[model samples]
Target: MTQKTFLVTGAAGFIGYHTSERLLARGDKVVGLDNLNSYYDVRLKESRLARLQQHENFRFIKCDLADKAGMEQVFRQHQFDVVINLAAQAGVRYSLTNPHAYTDSNVTGFLNVLEGVRHSGVPHLVFASTSSIYGANTKQPFSETQNVDHPLTLYAATKKANEVMAHSYAHLFDFAVTGLRFFTVYGPWGRPDMALFLFTKGILEGKPIDVFNHGDMVRDFTYVDDIVTGVVAAADNPPEGDKNWDGDEPNPATSYAKYRVFNIGNNKPVKLMEFIEAIEESVGKKAIKNLMPIQPGDVPSTCADVSALEKAVGFKPDTSVKVGVENFVRWYREYYRV
Candidate 1:
């Protein structure tokens, strides 16, 4: 396979930074795009960007996906062979307070991406979906075949909508699109709003860590390295249209169009208390747990069924939560001089 030029949206973000760095290490040219919104600490995002700037193959542009003209210009100027859309208004709880962010970034912004791919003749478009889309479903391990019609939060809804939107473009324009449903991703350089980062920070500061769902929750936390590996593999192996796909019994995982969805997770759901213990072990400090009820739009648990991803890519996420947490804590301590 030819090493193609890749465009990774949200390249300043945790997952995006890792993905872009890996691509650069492989000698692939990468055009990274980000708006650098103040949803979290801009300093952290800048810090991430600083690391990527060291790589010779990485070229970054400050732009939002919602900017149709800017996105169109990028598509027109660069002959992007693959586009990995990771930019979005992330967080289930944040959706409750800021619904417009989802609409503008996830919905409107995503539409612009589709337009770019449709016009630019890009072969594959791999975008980030979320496990939160499995909302209101009581399934043990969420499968790609399951119907994701019931989303509890605007964030989940936007992701679910992205899958549908991508499918439509694939059918209409013959573009290869794959939507990756990432389970709770964590590691060094992870978002501050995420659990592992928040818990580690609070524990180090001798502050109380908010334990949602009264510490009864579980998360299939995938490490950042594993996620980028899966993502790059998916980007290289674009989905072909299911020739034998039956319209009567539609399969959500694969379609008659060049579209598919796969869950990228550890496939091992760890309890919230266990996760906290892992952090405590890594940091050598016990967290002051402030037990609280489940917040609005927050799911109690998430476990991904990554068999399909394994079958497609011949790989699965194998990073243990303990190791992942330890790495984060180590980086945190060094980064903050704690």
Candidate 2:
């Protein structure tokens, strides 16, 4: 692939930082953008940004996605070949308390991204979606073709809105758009709020770790590198409009326009208790488990059908939970000096 200038939103974020790093490593010019909000740890976000700054080809832009003028200015200034949007108000439980944040960032902010890309004529717009959109559905290994009309949480709803929003823009503006539904992404420099980070911290600190759903939950824990691989591949291969797409028998994953959505995840689903055990082994400490009932707006399981992604990109996330957990543990120890 030829070197291309790219714009990566949420550059300070976990997945965003990793994706930007990969692009920079491959001799691509990257303009990394993030508001660096205190949604989690601002320090962690800053650290990620600092690393990206070390690359001469990478430029950091501290801008909020919701700022229409700022976003428009960014598009006007930079000639980005591809735009990867990973910025959003993340966390399902947090969405329950802070509902408006979801709309502000995921809905309105995503609209700004779409509009910017539309006007700038960016060939491909690849954005992050989530498996949470598969809420209330009992289907094993959620597929892109399934109807995601019933999102349990506001966050999921916002992401579902983003998918439709991108589809509309692709149809009206004639641009390629790919939405990646990431599943339980975790690895080095992972979010502190996520299960792996939280579990490691709590285990090392001798604190009781909360295990929801009575430790019966299952997640298709995808490694960040694997997720990034799928993301970059999707960016490299822009979707052509589905020629066989029928209006009467509509497929939710693809459209007649240049739009598509794929589930990029480890096809293997690991049990919650097994994941906790891996953390315990990695940290060499036992966790005092506070098994609790499944919280509202939370699902018992999430398994992604990655066939579409593999067929498209010739790659699939196959990282084992044991190895991924060990990598995270090593990073946690060194980063926090634990």
Best by lDDT: 2
Clash pairs for candidate 1: none
Model 2 lDDT tens row, 72-140? 999999999999999999999999999999999999999999999989989999999999999899988
The lDDT per prediction is 0.93, 0.95
Provide the clashing-pair count of each candidate structure: 0, 0
- Runs of candidate 2 with Cα error greater than 4 angstroms are none
Please list all clashing residue pairs in model 2, or write none if there are none.
none
Report model 2's TM-score to 2 decimal places. Answer: 0.99
Cα lDDT tens digits, model 1, 49-140, are 99999988889999998898999999999999999999998988888889999999999999999999989899999999999999999887
